[model samples]
Target: MKKPLLIDLDGVLRIGKEPSPHVEKFFDLINTLQIPSCILSNSTLSTTNDVRQFFEFNGIQTKIPILTAVEAAAMYARLRYRRVAVYCTDHVKSLFRGLLDYENPQAIIIGDYGKRWDFETLNYIFRKVREGAELIAMHKKRTWKTAEDGILLDVGPFVVAIEYATKKEATIIGKPSELYFASALSLFNLELHDPFIMIGDDLETDIEPAKKLGAETIFFNSEKGFTQEAILKANPDYVVNNLEDVIKILKEKF
Candidate 1:
């Protein structure tokens, strides 16, 4: 039986645009051992195709599949809501560009806008919500690590602002929500009992949800800034201090 590894990109393999020190070695081991792997991310900033390019540029040789929240949200909206007013970064907008018409949307979708979160955007989204638009949020992360000085804010605050103004709770589409996970799993044509593992830095979004679905999990402790104590509470199957440790564990287990 082949083991399927679900890997998270940020903090696990790379941070921002740079790859972790031992990420290449880990990929090499996966290739040498012919282990099947898939990349799963909660990022709404890029399309799946763009994510593939990012992995290619970062020296991940496998053409492994990528499943992102942006794609999942767009697909969900297409089936449920005909039109969506997305409050996200320009990068995320590019992901569902042709799929949805942004000029006038029927639902309000919110996510991280980085430093672009302003009163005007908030007011606009609130107005749409007041006009009876449904709310959908990609993820509720409070903050994320950046290449610059300190930690940067996430979409949680922005979602809060809209919720306060509209008096409506937004539907969460990313991790902790099993719908998105099931969607990714469906792409593999694999069974629930299959030997699968989820490796990620964050415990709440990556490890806990995968474990709930009966999959083995690996926790990659990248840095103190982005580390969450909840991960320890989740009790993953394996805990590695860094990306190299993943290779070591895989070698021993497989």
Candidate 2:
């Protein structure tokens, strides 16, 4: 059997609302080769089905699996806490359907609250954490880019603020988190020692964390203007500027 593969959704498969160039070809290559793969997302704003729909709408249909931070956080929270307060968009919040408990919750699950984030909300979470509630953060991404707004702040700063106030670190359930990657491996019935490849754009969140999990990484250098020294520091197994190159590399190696 071919080695299992893990792909990042945001920068690899899709860039903002536009699909990455040649992404369809990459998926076709995987399907034709029967490579086991799963697309990983750090999006606390959307769920697996939402991602699936986006791809389908874009005409990049495939049977490959997907796991989003929202779904992972819900699963993690469900396993540990009975009552939880989820902070995320309405669609994303539906994942934690049965577990939402704003009043006297056992834990506070923070995600992409968007424009709803304010002092009152932050203070509420802080007070809850002080009251001994566990803090669960979807992904601590400091910033992200948008098709309309360019680059904007993400959920990380808020999570860190709460951590600073409460003196408690929130359990991160997204990319760069060991638990998140481990959970992805489980989808393929894989163990840590099993061979795998991780492809993504971000060095800190994607490359470094996957490396720690023993995955051969392919850095999709989507953004231009990275000095050679920075790329060398990341030390990915392979570096490519496009998804079509990923297909070629996989064909040659696997």
Candidate 3:
């Protein structure tokens, strides 16, 4: 049987609001070949359905479900905490539903707040943690590539700052967490021994962790800041320049 494919969204399918030129074709090929795949992201800015809508609007008709760090965080919060304080964007905040209670929260969830992150906000979150709120970090990505703005700061820096102030480490609910990968695989009834491929850009969060889960990796070198030495350290099964090249690999390998 052909291996299932797990693909990262940022720096792979689209950057910022712009999908890559090869995106539509890539999705079509996946559908045509009947490849069992999932669009996985550590992004907290959008939900799985929102990603689906974005892809459809960009002309890629896909039935592929998304697995995001936000979803994982939300799932965890539902089982663990009843009331929580969200230090994320409005869209991400909505994922928590009834659990969101900034007044008196049991946990403080951190995600990408972009410009919303400032002295007052950070201090407030710090105080909350100091007051005994459990710190829940969504993901720790350092930076992300954009279609227009190039590289932008991700939530990692701020998450670390909160940790520094509170002296309490957050329970990470995203990539590099074995639970996230194991959960995704279990949903599809897959085992670690099954032939699988992971195509992503981030080495720490995407490549290395996926490898630990026994997935053969294909590092998509989406030009932000990757040195040859870095690539050597990653040592993926394949290195492809663009999404088009990834299509060829699927045809040849799968």
Candidate 4:
């Protein structure tokens, strides 16, 4: 069995507020095999612990902790900058409480800013970065899942917009971010090359990044199968339709 499995939350195991079917079975596999695993998500809508609690309440329970982009940002922000300007929902912004600096900040931490992504607000953040504040994006994921809207534009688009206007790059601290991946693996006492696998929905942020770390990646596509070109582009070790299919792959490969 894999020492630790890195799993993404949204789209991979759940969409919006609903947990995907067989999510409990997925956790059961890890537990039955005595494999260590943790939940990882790019969304900063809640703290890692909050996400875990949500999972337990919804039907999945795991002793393992969640590795969230917000927590990663909080850790990095505490060490790197004393004062920073943050852009995200109220729940997410709470992660940066003591470190926030609205005026003349040292860095600008951005996440799912939701309805405040208009031109005027973006330009205001641009002004901060232009004046020498570093940009720390939670993640560059392109889409966000919603119960009502299905999939919609996510923070990646807005972050890119600000980057273009300011001619500055953001330091991402979530999925696909090497440091973030490394940080999650560390919790399991596993290094980059250790025996592990990543199971997630996003080709770019989930499967692609795990491949970069030299770990086996299982791409969780929605339809019956992924395009051959998409398969070649992602080069995922395996692709499955849902989390339930992972049981067979683990039995075969691990």
Candidate 5:
């Protein structure tokens, strides 16, 4: 019997540049128990390969599949729009290398650029949009925590800027979008009722979407229930203080 567990990256497994406490023990337990797991992150910063390297660097042995919004967006672009003008950090830019021409792109894809956001980039994107280019965004998260600031701006504001300039909405490819969820599930060849769990820190992006897909959900509370109010509205199956609690529940349930 194969039990599927979907885990999020940011707050549940790591925070900023540091790995979460007990993450190593958690992975060891998974190996010891022989439980199958997958990492499904909403982050658009890194590619799936990069994510795998991060886990390996942290000494967490992960053979399970890794799905990220960047991969999802790429899949979406390949299916919908082939030639795209991307507005992402250089790290993320490397993922789409050779996929886009940038000479006369048909679409504008936006993601978090961190400190690289500036007037020059914005003007370039705006120029493309004015020329009738379509817009696509990874996720609409307003802000995310970083080592430099308590809360750094995310891709949401940039999406808003483009929309404000061009008056055209972006096709979202991340959480709250059923396409991404479906793509993740397809990788496991599992159905909706196949004893699956969604574990993440964000209530709206991770928990609600998984619940809508008929999967049981676990919220990894990071900000002391800052999202609890919204999560209670959706009514997840379980809520935990950290990933350790998630492991405990799996042990009892499975």
Candidate 6:
């Protein structure tokens, strides 16, 4: 049987607000091959439904399951805390419907606040954490790329700042976190050591964690920054330049 696959959505299938040129063909191959797979995105700004709409909007339709950091964080918050104050963009605030408590919260869930992250706002969150509210970060990605804006700071740096002030680590709920990876794996009823393939662009968040979890890694060498030597030293099982190349690798190998 073909191995289960864990796919990252952002750089692998989409870039910025647009779908990658070969994304449709890649999903088509995955569907034809009937690969047991799950689409994982560390996008705190988008929900699973939003991602589906994106593909549909781009005229590429498929029924592959999706799991985003926002959904996972909501699931995590609901299962643990009752009165939770979710600090995210208005787009995804509804995910934590029943747990929205800003006045007196038992837990503070941080996500992509975008331009709203100022000293006063961060200080408020810091005070809340110091006051005994558990801090849960949606994802700790240091930066993200945009089609127009180049690279911008993500929520990780803010999460780390709060951690620094509070002297406590926030429970990370996205990529590279074992809990996040395990949650995605569980969708296929697969465990950490199960034979699987991970396709992603970011080495730190996507490749490294999956490699540690025993997945055969495929580094999607789409973005710049890493040297050829750096990629080789990271030692992914396969490195492909595009989604077309990814299709080739899967057809030729797994």
Return the clash pairs for model 1, or none: none
How much lDDT does each candidate structure score?
Answer: 0.77, 0.89, 0.85, 0.83, 0.79, 0.88
How many residue pairs collide in each prediction? 0, 0, 0, 0, 0, 0
The superposed Cα distance between candidate 1 and the true structure at residue 86, in angstroms, equals 1.6
Model 4: per-residue Cα lDDT at residue 120: 78
Per-candidate RMSD, Å = 2.6, 1.4, 1.9, 2.0, 2.5, 1.3
Instruction: Give the Cα-based TM-score of candidate 1 against the true structure.
Output: 0.86
Q: What are the models' TM-scores?
A: 0.86, 0.96, 0.92, 0.93, 0.87, 0.96
Model 4 whole-model lDDT (C-alpha atoms): 0.83
- Model 6 lDDT-worst window of ten: 222-231
Residues 1-254 of candidate 1 have per-residue lDDT tens digits of 46688898788877777777877788788888888777777877777787777768865666677888877787778788767777677777765565465567878777666787788888888887888888888887777877775677788778887899778998888765777666666667775445578998887788887888888899887674444466667889988888778888899878
TM-score of 2: 0.96
Candidate 6 ranges with C-alpha deviation above 4 Å? none
Where does candidate 5 have its weakest 10-residue lDDT segment? 223-232
Name the runs in model 5 displaced over 4 angstroms. 1-3, 32-35, 191-195, 224-228
Cα lDDT over the full model 1: 0.77
Q: Name the top lDDT candidate.
A: 2
